[model samples]
Target: MTAHVVQRSTAETTLMRQFETEKLSSSPRRADAFGRFIAGGLPTRRVESWHYTDLRAAMRDAAPLAPAPDSGAIEDARAILTDRKRMAAWRIVLVDGRLVAELCDQFPPAVSFSREEPSPVDVDDPMVALNEAMSVEAYVLKVADGARVEGLIEITHISTAKDARSVYSRVAILLGIGASASLIESYLGAGPGVQRNSLAILTLAEGARAKHVVLVEDDAELHIESRLGQLAAGAELNDFVLISGGALTRRQLFHKLIGPEAKITLGGLTLLDGKRRSDTTLQVVHAAEAGTSREYYRAIVDDEAVGTFQGKVIVENAAQKTDGAMKSQAVLLSPRAQMNAKPELEILADDVVCGHGATVGSLDPEQLFYMMTRSLDRDEAESMLLEAFGEEAIRRIEDDVLAEALRRPFWAWLARERVARVGGEGEIHWVESAS
Candidate 1:
C-alpha cells in the first residue's frame, strides 16, 4: 500500500513566476487565471477527486515557502480564535495563509464580490494550480436578495510553526434569491510541522439557502488539504465535516445542482487515533431538473489510523426527477486500524433515483454483551456500545452545542482506545444479553 507521484517543482516553478504578474489585475479573467495557475501544480493520486489525497506526495517534502509573517504567529492565531466556544457568525481570519485584514470585519454593502480567476477546469488540478498560483487574498461574500444571515459565518485557518506553509486561501460565497446562511470553516493549530492548503467557492441563487461546517483540529503533525464548491438554483445545501487532529487529513466536497429544485445535504465525521490519517471526498452533480442529493459518512479508526471514503453521484440527462442517496459507514477499533469505503453511482437518467451504500464493521459483540449485562464495564461496555453507534451518526447533527462539540474529541478517542485495549482501566461488567 504505497502511493506518491507529484510533479512541478522548481519551487513550484519559482512560485509561479511570482504570482504571475500579481494575478493580472483588471482581469482578463485574471489573465486567464494566471494562465490556469501556470498549468496546474498540486493535485496528484492522478486526480479522480485526488484519488485518496496525495497533494504531490504530501507537498513533496514541502517548503515552497509562505510562513514568515509572525507576530508570535499572530498571537498564536488570536488564541485559537478566542477558544471557539461554539463560535457562530462573522469571522474570516487567515494567518499562515495570509489575510488578517485587521482581524476581519466589514462587508454588508449589499454583499457583492469578485477576484475569481482560474479555470480551464483548473488545468488538471495541481491542487487547483497550487490554489491558482499561490493566492494572496480573496474573501468574497455576497448575500443580497432576500438576505437572512443573522448568525454563523466563520472562516478561520490559523497556524503556528509546523513549517512547509502554503495557503492559497479563497472563499467566495454568493447567495441571493430567498437567501439564508450559515458557514463555518475552522482549521486551528499549535505547533508540530504543519502544512495547510485550502480553497472554497460557493454560489447559490434561486431560492438560496446554506449551512456548511468544516473543522479540522490541528497539530498531530498537521498536513491538511481542502477544496469546496456548491452552486445553486432552488438551492439548499447543508454540508458538515469534522476531523480530529491530523497527521494527514484531507477533505473535499463538490456539488453542482445548477437549478430546478436543487437540494444537497452531505455529512462526514472522522476520528482516527495515534498514527492518524483521514480522508473524505465527495462529488454530487445532478445539473438541473428535479435535483436532490443526500450523502452520509462516518468513521472511527483506532490506533495505526487510516480512514478514507470516496463517494460519488452524478445523474445527467437533464437530471430527470433525480433523487440520489449515498452512505458510507465504518467502525474499526484497532487490530491495526484501517477503514476504506467507496460508494458510487453514475446514471444517465432513466427517470433517475440513484443509490449507493458501503459498510465496514467491528464493535458490536452483541452490543458488547448487551452492555455487559446491564451494569456496564468492559471499558464501560465498549464506551456504551460505541456511544450507541456514535449516537446514530451524531443525531444527524441538528446541532446541540455542535453535536456535543463533535462528541468531545470522539469521547477522548474512545477513552484512549480503551486504555490501549484493556491493559488497564478495564472493568464495568453489566452482563445481560438479547436482541
Candidate 2:
C-alpha cells in the first residue's frame, strides 16, 4: 500500500510558510493563534459558521503581505481627504496597515494614543485568529473617564499596493467610565486583487457611551473584518457597518454584555452588484441582568450578487428581563441575485424576551408602477425604492453629520447605476434618468 498525502491549497501553503516566518511567531500568543489557523487551514462550506460563504475557496492564492505604503501612496491617500469640514473629525491614517503619524490629525485632549499592541485576546473566530497571527501593525486608543471627545475620531485604512497583496491591521478602543465618543473607520482600497484582514476590539466601561461606524470605500477582492466588544453596566454601544465594496466580504461581530442594564444597537447595510458576495454575521450574548439589544440589517443585491446575514443572540440564565430582537431584510434586484438570512435566538432565561426574523423580496411592482405613474423612470423608481428601503438602517444613526457623511457613499453607489462619478459626495446623478 502506498502512503497517502493530504495536499493543501496554494493559499494555505503560502500562509503556512508565512506563519513559520511571522515576525511575532516567537511570541506564545501569536504562536497559539497560528496554531489555531493551521489546525483549521481555512473556513470552508463545511464549517457551520461559514456555510454561506466559503472563505477557503474564495482565497485560492496567498498574496504576500503588503509592505509599508510608499510616500506616493501616502500622498495619494491625503488627496482623498475631502469635506474636511464634514469628516472634520480627527484622523488616524494607516497606509498599507502601518500608521503614518504625519498624515493624521490632532486627537482630542482626553484621548491617548499608542502604537503598542495589547496582549492578544483569545478568540475562536478564524478571521480574528488570522489577524492576530499575521497583523503587522496594531494600536490602542484610550478615552479618559468623564471626558467627552469633542470631535469624532476617524481611523482611515488605505490599501495603496497595486499588486496582489494581503494587509493585516488591528485596532483597539477603550472608553473609560462616563466617557462618550464617536468613531469612524474608513477602509479605502487603492487597487484590485488584494486581500485584507482587519480586526477591532472595543471595550465600554460602566456608564460609557460610544457610536462607531465601519465604512468600506470601494471594491476589493477579499475583505474580512472581525469586531469584538464587551459592555459594562449602564454602557451603551451603537454601531453601523456599510458594505458597499469588495467582491467577497465577510464581516463578523461578537459581543458580550457582562454588566447589568447594558444596551447594544447595531445596523448593517450592504450594497452589492456584479458578482459580489458579502456576509454579515453577528453573535451577541446577554450574560447579566436587564440587557437589551436590537440588530437590523438591509441588503440590496443586484446582478449576480449574493448577500447574507447571519445573526444570533443568546441570553444566559442569569440574564433575567433581557430583551433582544434581530431582523434582516433584503431586496434582490435581479433574478440571478441571491440572499441568505439566518436569524437565531438561544435563550436560557425564562423571563427574557427574544425574537428573530428575516424577509427577502424584490421591489413591489405596484409601488414601482405608482412611481412611474408620477412620471418617474422605471430604473429611477427602482433606485428610489432601494434607497428608501435602506434608509431605515441609516436613520438609526443619532448624529446628523455622521448620518450625512454615511449617506454620501450610498448616493455614490446609486449614481454608479446610471452615470459616471462626478466630483463631490453630494454630487449624485440627481437630474440623470436611471433608465
Candidate 3:
C-alpha cells in the first residue's frame, strides 16, 4: 500500500481552476472553505508557519481573477481617490476587490457599512482557507454600542490592476460594548504583475477599544495579508503594521485574548529593498484570566532583500496572570541583505509572564562613525541610523496623529533609501517624498 501524491503547484493548479469557476462555489460556506483549500496546498518550506515565506515557491502561476471595476476602472479609482490627501475621518473604498460604493465616504451615526457573506473562519489557515474560498464579498464595518468614534477609520484597498492580475478581499471589523475606534488599512495601487489575497476580521465587544493602522504600499507581485483578532472582557487592541510594498510579501497575525483583562499591542515595520521579500508572522493567544500582550517588530534589509520575523506567545490553561512581551529587530543594509528572526513563548498557566526576543545586526559602525565625525555623509549617516531604527516601531503608536501617519511612510521609506544610495548600485530611482 503506497499512495503519497500531493504535488500541485502552478499556483495550486490555478487555485483549483479558480475554485471551479466560482459562483461563490455554491456556498455552504464557500464549499467548506474550498474544502480547506483543497486540503492544504500552497504554503511551503514545509509550512512550519510557512518557514520564512515560501508560499508555494513564490506563487508560480495563478494571476487572472480581478475583474469588476471598469467605468474606466472606476475613473481610475476616482483619480486615485481624488489625489489622495485626507488620511482619514471616515473613508472606505476598495476597488479591484469590490466594495466601491460611489467611491465611499459618509459613515457616522455610529458608523455602519455592509456587504456581508464571507464570515465563518475558525482558522486552520491555508491562507485562511484560501481567503474563505476566493472571497466574493465581505466588507462589514460596524460600531454602535457605546460608540466614541472621532477621527480615523480609513479602509482603502485599491489595486487597479495594470497587467497580470488576481485579487480577493474580505474585511470585517466590529466593536460594540463600550466601543471606541480608530483604524486605517490602506494598501494602494497594484504594479509589477499583481496578485493579492487579503483578509481582515476583528471583533471587540466588552469595554471595547481599538486602534489599528496597516499600510502596505502595493507594488504587488504577490502579497498576502491575513489578520484575525478577537478580544472581549475589558477589551483593548492596538496594532500597527507598515511594510513598504511587495514583490513577494507575507503578513499574518492571529490574536485572541478571549475575555478577562484582554489587551494587546502589536507593532511592525518592514522595509526591504530590491529583490524584495518581506514576511511578518505573529500569533498571540492568552485565552482568559489576566491577559495582556505586547509584540514589537522592525526590519530594514537592503539590496537582494529579504526580511522575516516570526513571533508567538501563548498562555492557556486558563491563562492565569498572563502578561507577555516579544521583540524583534533587524537592520542589514547590504552585503546581500537578509534577516530572519523567530521569537516564541508558550506557557500553560502557573501564573504566566511570558517573554521573547530576537535581533539581527548591521548599521551602527560606532553609530556610523559618530555620524561620520559630526557632519554626516555616507548616505547621511546611514539615513540617520535608519531613521532612528524605524522610529522604534513608530513609537508604539499612542496616536500622535496616528504616530505621524505611520511617520509619513517611515519618512518615505527613508527618502527611497537616500535615492537608492545616490543613484548607483543597479541604478535605482524614485524620489517622491512628502508623504
Q: Which candidate is the best by TM-score?
A: 2
Q: Positional deviation of 172 in candidate 3, in angstroms?
A: 21
Tens-digit per-residue lDDT, 1-435, candidate 1: 115654566656556555654443445554455565445555567767767766566554544456446677787777767665746546777776677767766656655444443233322344544554456666667789898877676777776665655555666677888888777777777355655667776777888887777777776353545455555667887777777787877776666787888888788778788787888877787877798888888887887888999988888888899888889888888688888788888888789777888888888788788868887676776767666666566656565545655665556666666677776663332222111
Write model 3 residue lDDT over 39-149, tens digit each, in one string: 878877888988988888778888988988888888888898787678898888888778888888888899898898635658788888888788777778989999999
How many collisions between residues are there in candidate 1?
A: 19
Count of backbone collisions within predicted model 2: 0
* TM-score ranking, high to low: 2, 3, 1
Question: RMSD in angstroms, all models?
Answer: 20.8, 3.8, 21.9
In angstroms, give how far residue 401 of model 1 lies from its true place. Answer: 36
What is candidate 3's local distance difference test score? Answer: 0.84
lDDT of 1 at 262: 84
In candidate 2, which residue ranges exceed 4 Å CA deviation? Answer: 1-6, 82-86, 420-435
What's each prediction's TM-score? 0.32, 0.94, 0.33
Ranking by lDDT: 2, 3, 1
